[model samples]
Target: MTDVVSEPTTVTGVDTPPASPARGRWDADEHGWFGDFGGRWIPEALVAALEELTVAWKDAMADESFLAELDAVGREYAGLPSPLYEAKALSEKAGVRVLLKREDLLHTGAHKIRNVLGQALLTKRMGKKRVIAETGAGQHGVASATAAAFFGLDCTVYMGAVDTRRQALNVARMRLLGAEVIPVESGSATLKDAINEAMRDWVASVDETAYLFGTAAGPHPFPSLVQSFTRGIGDEARAQCLERYGRLPDAVAACVGGGSNAIGLFTAFLDDPDVAVWGFEAGGDGVDTDRHAATIVGGGAGVLHGSRTMILADSDGQTVESHSVSAGLDYPGVGPQHAHLAATGRASYEAVTDTEAMDALALLARTEGIIPAIESAHAIAGALRIGPRLAAEHGPDALLLVNLSGRGDKDMVTATRWFGLDPETATTDPVGDPDSDPRA
Candidate 1:
């Protein structure tokens, strides 16, 4: 962050070479469209605020002081430049050297902190005394709350009632961090609904409140803005890979919920054609079933949450309810950039079943002694699924860096039920057994 990376400028009309093919067409055009995906689609009243946010973000990106401040907060407060860990046992299973970007080890136990802190700084720059966001899995809500606490800003988070129940620990954690967590019960009682509620609140309070978007999926500036904050994941990973492996990774894998983490990693390597990029979506029961959050795989191009992108929708254009056991990935729409990537073949998108993600989660915990968020487990599962192919393409020493977006402590309850583990069931070993039944 010492030197900020500016967004790609639209070189249309009299464009000479189209912004160098190697650097990727990631910059939003003058209209803010990423290959016809991103745009500003909110009410007229919010236009001034959105434009103001965009200008502030662009100014901040161009400012050295802002970049240095962000870097300082990331390293000193968020424990950033999180290490790249080589998972030996996992590599054995995948037939490649599987490297994991250890964002799970970050200060808030998640990569969400990076973007939250950046946006929080923007809030201060805007002279806002309050911040707001909507979260599905609670990782973002927790991050927003933590940043608000640090800046002494009043924070409000909107979460679906269902997420409130599923991610109860995160709810408690957010409350403890001094955030007002409101549970939205409208619509499917999930993330999309919570987003609706949050937007409504933002429209009413934009003058004094900054809606710190949780993902890269929202309107124009957000997709680019969030990616700007998170590209550090790929920035650090790419450097570490070169230093460790003497070259770029053969592939990079990251889970796609609203597509922030995947875009974060993919941006660094988009210019490297040799390094394959994979984005895994939550398959829920399976993509073949009615339940899944496989936006790119099973969805069509549409607008949702203000941006034109691939979305889970019916024939009438109503957003369908997406299902994923991992609360983090249960979204109907993805970031516009991801849609563009999949459409243009810059990146591959696939779905991993809930069972597969869970298995991968357990495998990583047992092998690397690192428990990963179920959202990240989708990426782990994806690497396991595609590693052999990469080896065939790149050789036995093929490398893939998986973005471990967050720690699994927030998902223990779901894991306990999934694996039928009884907390009361004592094991002869210190590590409790997942198969042991307390009733026995």
Candidate 2:
């Protein structure tokens, strides 16, 4: 990869706090460097586009009319302020107080809708007629297509061929929403490859097309931009905890692929020294194995997908393919801001194996009747493993907030196969005993 290195510079108005708690030392600098990570590392062809987007985003954030419109659209169309629920059954089983930020209940059934809606609105403000995006598990693709249709903008999404098959339902959903779905067959045929194709398209069509990056990774403005849009996940959860339970959660957790949802939920609690932040990365088998996507836990610093961050790279600095059962978490690199967070000891990250995540998924489905996306299941698994220890130290009152990043409707195929469910009969006695009390 071509590395773009630059000296750090001071950020001015860009550091303005959102509606949530002040970021304090967590804000990115002027050139978008969040400590040693985050910067515009791309071919010279895309520099102008990034610069333009940076200015446009800053301007839009300053405009009250634009802000109001984004808020209105989010509430009326994309479902903002998703409710927070105490997962009583889950808490009882885990031996800790578990509260779920129900992003899965949002309009598009994921936190991705928030970012897409904001970017789509910005696209319109920039007079772009079309938008292009890259997706892994397809939540972002579905959200982008939904936003494009709502805004009367043409949309095209690039997805990995492997993911296209695994997430075929989402591909159909995107097509139904009027998006052109392109299956990328290059380089491991995963999220990174899709991003490569999207960046190429963006470079060629910079004038009339805006690249609505799905994650809080990529170059300068994107990481910051995506965070600004999705930070509501944490902001709302923080307030909900205060109003409902009379205090903030003792700890917060989310899955980290490209780190958007994790960053979104972590932003509001970053300044709260008492609240511990945790990120769970996909561990296909284990971090000790070659097959995994635990970037923060297993990778080193390198440039990938336009930002210098923690990535799975070889001794020669070549990109290494990452693996995970959940397509959303099968990425080799993480968001630059996440790298900074990990480096500064602001957040702790761990790897959750596929078996662990799948078990957590089943547990949630059985106990709480909530089937979370496999990506989110990683967070659940991590929380379950750590919850009891935390409870031991802090007593039963220790509260853990988990971001249910997406629903599992799109993952039924994978789930069915994993659990060996009878697809023909649509019933199985695999997980629990059928002879026992049905509800028990």
Candidate 3:
């Protein structure tokens, strides 16, 4: 166990796509997860307003008209409820059962679509003509832009200069979707800076713009909002698991960047208690070093991004540099609900190192033929640890569910180069950081 932050707390192979193709129907009335978790913990100026918006969201989920509109948009435009697939080879290899909630197969190749779709629908209802968001990995930006295009709304995405260069293809994707991407060059020129710039923009233009955030952190309504849209993951997994295994999985696992995917999958099992839940954090090198975003394991309670949560910070409350192989999980703070769950000891948190995640990535590629995003590979790595434990402690037939948040297509350049495989030269084991900006 490590200090500073505080103490806290599977495998398969398959030729699964980055995300599953949208399928199945969603029960809109199952908003209990969002109702209990998402709430406004912001400035008084935004509190009552957020409350009203929550009321509308609740009403919308219940309104057959609103459900029909969302369903229509999902099918013809947004593509809702991506598939859940069983990782047969990988599960057999792991000596335990494993299933994947394929969010990567969405239109944008990530779970970001679930959130953006919900936010976009809410924006239209609020009569907002413009939407602004902040992104670290660019998945959110692409998803937001996709939603904006579908809704005919103007979208602006704030990204760190560093991330823009590292994820250049995503920048192009956002632009192609007709969203203006602003690269922030201030501060560390990474995620935190982009977030700061987005806050400034939101404060200045709060009247006609809705800030569609990317994760389950931030203030109230956001954790709730994003979760509402994302619960489709768990809902699908439950039925799929039952269909495949004849019972619920013994455990559910997902990578926790801002805790969106993990929360989405874990929400349904919160009351079950018997269905164990695990959230994996980025252990860049190791939690022993200051080179990870394992907030609940290596950080402390603090206010960040408009909410009280565990944040990686220095003694003076200034955020510290967080390092992780996955750009998506390299943030210093996490969602408030994760912080709450970690505190209450209802769930467990652990760290997955860069090497472990990479190994998991390779194993999946070779065994199941599915290439996972590096961020999600962390969860796969953690599942490897869980699978063996459950197989031994429970039974040889213990079932495990892993949320594959996104695909590896966006990360191939980095992954190939990180593992010393040169895509251009067709040489395996190439070296050096793949994120070096060609024009920098």
Candidate 4:
């Protein structure tokens, strides 16, 4: 990065601009930033709703009373300022300095809670009585349910039948939180189907309900809204990294499941050209195989569920199935901002295989005593693959921060069975069919 003198600025509350164009694109009047590919591409019916949401969010951002209430809830109820843990043990094992942003410690055990809370607050202010959302790993479902219970609102979570079957515990948790969990059996019976169902509900009940989208994808305000709500992760991580280390980390990494967590951590560091941003997408069997969810790495432009983003679509533009070890990372599309970031060379996207992510899961558990969600394991996988490359190319002193997006408590049973581990006994490697082991 080239250094230059600052310029005089006249805007009352705005800071002076950097000497160079922002590494990521920004709209001063719109108050939205893009990497070059993000914009609203949706049906006409959603335009009004999205514009309303944008206006409401801007108002909330400016409302001191709303900010005070949100701040109090975040601190006293949702546990803000989650720890930026120094992963000394894992760092030693990886041969790189690694830090983990413990978003898992937040209420409902994932970063999804942050967006849900902010959106739910807006829902309340909008005088909506019902909140609807879609979930994959059930993280967002659980988070929405938690928020609904906290604010005394009706919550409905649409999940695919496959997800409900795979994440039974999360289903029960949502029920316990007083939410109605409806399983969508149409289409592939996965996240996409659930999203379609939620959109239908939203379109029908736009007057009485608010749809709290789970990730930084979907229509207009969602990518921007979720990013704003999740920016705290990066904000805290940036400050903590500076305080702990003498400077910013060489790179920040996270898994890109609809790209919420990635965008969250990436936004704060976007202006810093020296720091690299990496997003790991799930490579289920392998990127070479037919069954992977690496949309950014292996997909093409197409519209899906109201957004014009890169999706796993066939040549005819039909949506295709996606596979991943973690349900959360199995979506066929990613947030448009991520697509833009990739297009502009502002960020890099990599695919992490199921075997690789599972290996990362075990490595983090044994080496750091912290079991991360499969979604987060993708970041660990990225660290393993990218850490050595960066160290060899840059230097050994290069710093790496992996967003440990969520804990793995919800995945124990599934992981155990998938790895063929005896529930009663300790295990190291995950279970796989010997005949199905592609590496073998």
TM-scores for the candidates: 0.91, 0.93, 0.86, 0.90
In candidate 2, what are the lDDT values of residues 400-430, reduced to their tens digit?
9999999998888889888878657555477
Q: Alpha-carbon error at 228 in model 2, in Å?
A: 0.5
Candidate 1 clashing pairs, residues 3+ apart or interchain: none
Ranking by TM-score: 2, 1, 4, 3
lDDT of 3 by residue, 1-440 (tens): 12223211121323222121221111112321221232344567665556666677777777778767777776666556677777877786667888888887778887778788888888898888999999998988999999999889999999999999999999999999999999999999888888888878877777888888899888765766677678778867766666555566788999998988887887765644467789999999999998999999999977787777888999999999899999999999888777767766667899999998988887777767789999999999998888888899778688888999999998888787777676567554343323221222
Ranking by lDDT: 2, 1, 4, 3
lDDT of 4 by residue, 18-69 (tens): 2223223431225233533456666678778878888888788789898788
Q: 263-308 in candidate 1: lDDT tens per residue?
A: 8888887766666789999999998998999999999999898899
lDDT for position 63 in model 1: 92
Which regions of candidate 3 fall more than 4 Å away from where they truly are? 1-52, 76-79, 423-440
The models' CA-based lDDT, in order, is 0.87, 0.89, 0.78, 0.83
Where does model 1 exceed 4 Å of error? Answer: 1-24, 424-440
Which stretch of 10 consecutive residues in model 1 shows the poorest summed lDDT?
A: 11-20
Instruction: Find the candidate with the highest TM-score and give its number.
Output: 2
